[model samples]
Target: MTVGFVAFHYPRPEDFDDFVARVHQIAGVLRSVPGCLSADCWITTDGDDAVVSTGQWESDAAFAASFAAVAAADVDVTFDERERRPRQIIKLASR
Candidate 1:
């Protein structure tokens, strides 16, 4: 399986609600993509303003194709300009 991890940060606390709404839209789009196994969003409640998305796919190719579609549609913009949070992706290996 291929997995994707996305990170987001909102500098303004007032934008939390709006950020969640945007996350919902992104999750919906991911679910509609072919070969997407699952997609979920997580928010940190530890006084840190960050949101993360974890997505599972059938294979790396599946993730690439779906992500390309997302980028093409300009749906990957979830962070505010003031937020400097960095996004990272990792590939897991089975033992």
Candidate 2:
């Protein structure tokens, strides 16, 4: 089955542009991995500043492999939300 993940990132207003840039870079890295169907970023034009990133894989195993490759590559992205809050991650699969 096709699989994917979505993550919601909340960075202070001052860090918004930098955070978006880093997420785009990560998406670029994800696109290089085999079986990665898509990798992209999104943001809202209004409301509380937030960012979203998504990655889709051809299969469950492919999704896992993509994660492994991203981890192994160690994309240099370091921006933490205030008080070290973690980003929200949601897994996805086609029914």
Candidate 3:
């Protein structure tokens, strides 16, 4: 029963690099947490301001544990997002 989250994000034009950097930093932190299977970040070749991140876990319990770990580590995951179309989140479950 693995679970995951995929997020679509848009950075302010001038904030793209900084936003992506923060995404990578957070992903790195999550990867070290127990039960985190994979954490990845990506940017589109045709889109300069778009960033995508995915976090996968071993199970629902693992997902919860990872969130707790992230909170305990005091990792700031927020970014300067685009005003018009901020961030979108999607939850996933393994079939």
> Where does candidate 3 stray beyond 4 Å?
79-84
Tell me the tens digit of each residue's lDDT in model 2 across 20-65: 8888888988888889999999996789577899999999887887
Which residue pairs overlap in candidate 1's backbone? none
Clash count, one per candidate? 0, 0, 0
For candidate 2, the 10 contiguous residues with the lowest summed lDDT are 76-85
Which lDDT value does model 2 have at 78? 61
Candidate 3 steric clashes: 0
**Whole-structure CA lDDT of model 3:** 0.81
Put down candidate 3 lDDT per residue, 1-95, tens digits, no spaces. Answer: 89999998887777778778878878887888889999999987885557899999999988888777777776667544442376898999999
**Selected candidate, larger lDDT, 1 vs 3:** 3
Per-candidate TM equals: 0.73, 0.85, 0.86
lDDT of 1 by residue, 14-87 (tens): 76676666766777777778988877778888878776666777777777777776776756465445454554
**lDDT for each candidate structure:** 0.66, 0.82, 0.81
Residue 52 of model 3, lDDT score: 90
Model 3 lowest lDDT segment of ten? 75-84
